[model samples]
Target: MVRNSRILIVDDVVDNIRVAMNILKEENYEFSFAQNGGEALRLIFEVGESFDLILLDIMMPGLNGFEVCKKLKENPTTQEIPIIFLTAKVDVDSITQGFSMGAVDYITKPFHAAELLSRVATHLELYHSRELLLKHNINLKAKAKHEKNRLLSELEDSQKEMIFILAELMEATSDETGKHIKRVAETSALLAKYHPCLNDEDVDLLYHASPMHDIGKMTIPLEILHKPERYSEDEFSLMKKHTINAYSLLSHSDRKLIKAAAIIAHEHHEKWNGTGYPRGLKGPDIHIYGRIVALADVFDALTHKRHYKEAWKIEDAVAYVLDHRETQFDPELVDIFQEHLDEFITIAISQ
Candidate 1:
């Protein structure tokens, strides 16, 4: 006995509707009644979720049981409420049509109180189980999504820590301090933000990857990096190999940040016009990341004093970059750089 369950009885015969009502009265169930299909639909809609099960009369006047059943099933709000056909027609075709119209079961006229109650109880239990299962599925999906996001965040942090450790190793062996890589990361991110082709995620990737652009410089002799004068032609040739050396160090990693770092390390030296060293990739053939980092590296190099050179004036360094636009940098990137020139200047000056 489901004391809280509600049933709606739709019948043209007043005595039959009263008889069904009386049978359920002893069970402490709630009841609603309608004289025809039209009245049943109106009462159901007006009461809104008032009935858990519907005992529908097939031969009612004005929108008969089949039509009402079809309408109820088509409506999302009432579609899941189970329906049972209470009809005089016992033919196979009528029963089949009733089931097809969304009836859970059919009862011939003069149904026993036991038979009616049994069918109602069975379908209500099934409906309640399905609803519970649906809620459980939704909760499981949310939990799984949250767990997936947590793992991804941890993995990103771990990768970033590893890259920074390697970057600091290179900085320790060179004249430049950590500030050089920090400026490059910030400036590159700003430039990437303004570029239409790079989304927010790409901008973030560039910031982390740009700092490791010179990790290969760790392989160079400290004497060459710390020299008081410009490199000899032979020394310069050897210095260029640090680009290839960097590629060799970081290229093997399958991680996305590391892979991006490898591309920057290998191709940042290559120029847009193909006059640059190493692979000599030209124009669009060179990765956009390499082209982006190239400007950042040179800008930082010119504005900061190294053992081999004094710091250039801000205006002088800006002139050098714009002068080499297509010859050394991506032309469109250079245009974006010019638009955000003041922002880059601020970053370069800070620390």
Candidate 2:
């Protein structure tokens, strides 16, 4: 496609320029000519992008074709412009040097007009085909990106449907209704929305993901999870196994949402001071998603009516969390939480 376009001829000899221009003219090909390497370099720099191919002479005064080709190769803007050497130099070393300096082909002097025309045509066709292949590659990348986004959107919708179903199953097993998990999910999303480190996507993921925090509880028997009395030592140990069960349930998937869900399931029960879980993970040992869900889950449990206890006042719930900052929560995260406490309460009340 590009070979059918403009070609530039560079040589100092007037007769040679006339002959080459005439040969190309009969085929209706457009062309430009420069007398010497210096003049050709100037013309190319000025309108280089328009020229598809060049016929270069190697024996010109003040910057020979080899020097010109070397200069063209140095300028990134003109480096890839193909050059065909039209010169008298026929020795093996000179021909090798022409290619080394970046000329695409060597055509010796006293040249046949037909051979020159045919070589020019072949190089131009190859250049145009390479351009077409590059365009196709760019289109392929864009199409692949579009398909990936579509698949991700479908997967997110499917995961939400599964979470809702799983939440219902958990509610069916426990004395507390599904509203508890729903409230926690809403509250966690609100907290993440106002958090400085989280973006809109992170907030949305946390919203859907936080509800699955107690999914491990599905493995705990109804007697331990729903009992209206304090748990015995053996029952408490079995109760703690819920975290591992939750991790097991969600860990095998490669999906990002499920991976996040697995992390929350395993670490939400972990305390900041290394004292409150089957693993006793401390401080940053807990992933940020787990820390965020921990605060949301505990706050909702404190402020909502439960089978075993009455709901505490909103102020009381806040005070309990603030007082136990380093012991129960990451101190730095608690500082961010305290700054956004009012908003958290508003979201809780609204929901």
Candidate 3:
């Protein structure tokens, strides 16, 4: 295959070109010629990756072969075009310099036609072999990536199903009714979509990750969670541990969604005024994941009926959030949430 490859010849010497062309053409190779490095560059660019190998002469006028080779290596499109120097300079330093400038091999002038043809055939064979190897590597990487993504999708689906079953089971233990975790996930996603710092992928991560916010409640006793009255100091102290429990439950994984879940689990109960439990983290000290979920959880709790109280109207819930913007919630997020209230409500109702 390589003997039949197209070879470009660059030399200022006319006799050398004729001799090499005659010898290589007999071996079934196609030939293109250039008188100097400058003309060779123009011809190579015009051909645009058509030649399999280049035979460059070092001592040509106006941008010698080394200069042409340097330019070709700098261009990603042309860099892989193999170059072999055909030069008269036989010194070790000259040969090393040509190889360093990206020549695959060098043949000194006063060269035998047989030697030139043999070197050309060898380099072309190497080039084709490299091309095959690169193609195989690319195919292998694509297949690996596809398999990884497929497994990731399956893992995410399993987590969602587990969350739904767990959330429903926990809700059954308490007095809450219908889609509490789903609503929080939807609202968190809605708020994140309009957030400047969050991209589409980040928003989706938060959306899926937010439902795990109360996952710690699974560890809390049913009596406390179902209590129809206010929590006693002892019960409240125990309740605070849920945040750490939440973090611990999801913190084991290094995945982005799991990490986001950990942040939400640990920080959602924190207050803007530094009074929140588990950590007295205040204001922007809280992770945006935590801040976003706090609002979602509160809004859903306010608008949904519980064993302890009737649901507040949407208007009343809005007023409550607006009233406590800096005290109970992150004010910037609160404002964005309020601005997109209709979208949030629409998602809530759909859920």
Candidate number of the best lDDT: 1
Cα lDDT tens digits, model 3, 154-178, are 9988876776676677667667754
Query: Which 10 residues in a row give candidate 3 its minimum summed lDDT?
Result: 169-178
Stretches off by above 4 angstroms in model 3 are 11-13, 36-38, 45-50, 56-119, 348-351
List the candidate numbers ranked by lDDT, top first: 1, 3, 2
Q: Scored by Cα lDDT, where does model 1 land?
A: 0.89
Error of 2 at 260 (Å): 2.1
Ranking by TM-score: 2, 1, 3
Q: What is the lDDT of residue 345 in candidate 2?
A: 84
Which scores greater on lDDT, model 1 or model 2? 1
> Pairs clashing in candidate 2?
none
Q: What is the C-alpha lDDT of each candidate?
A: 0.89, 0.84, 0.85
TM-score of each: 0.83, 0.86, 0.80
Q: How would you encode candidate 2's per-residue C-alpha lDDT over 137-240 as one tens digit per residue? A: 99999999999999989988999878867977887788667787778888778777777788988888888877788888889888788788888899999999
Which pairs of residues have clashing backbones in candidate 1?
Answer: none
Error of 2 at 62 (Å): 2.0
Candidate 1 lDDT trough over 10 residues, lowest sum: 42-51
TM-score head-to-head 1 vs 3, winner? 1
Give the TM-score comparing model 2 with the true structure, all chains together.
Answer: 0.86
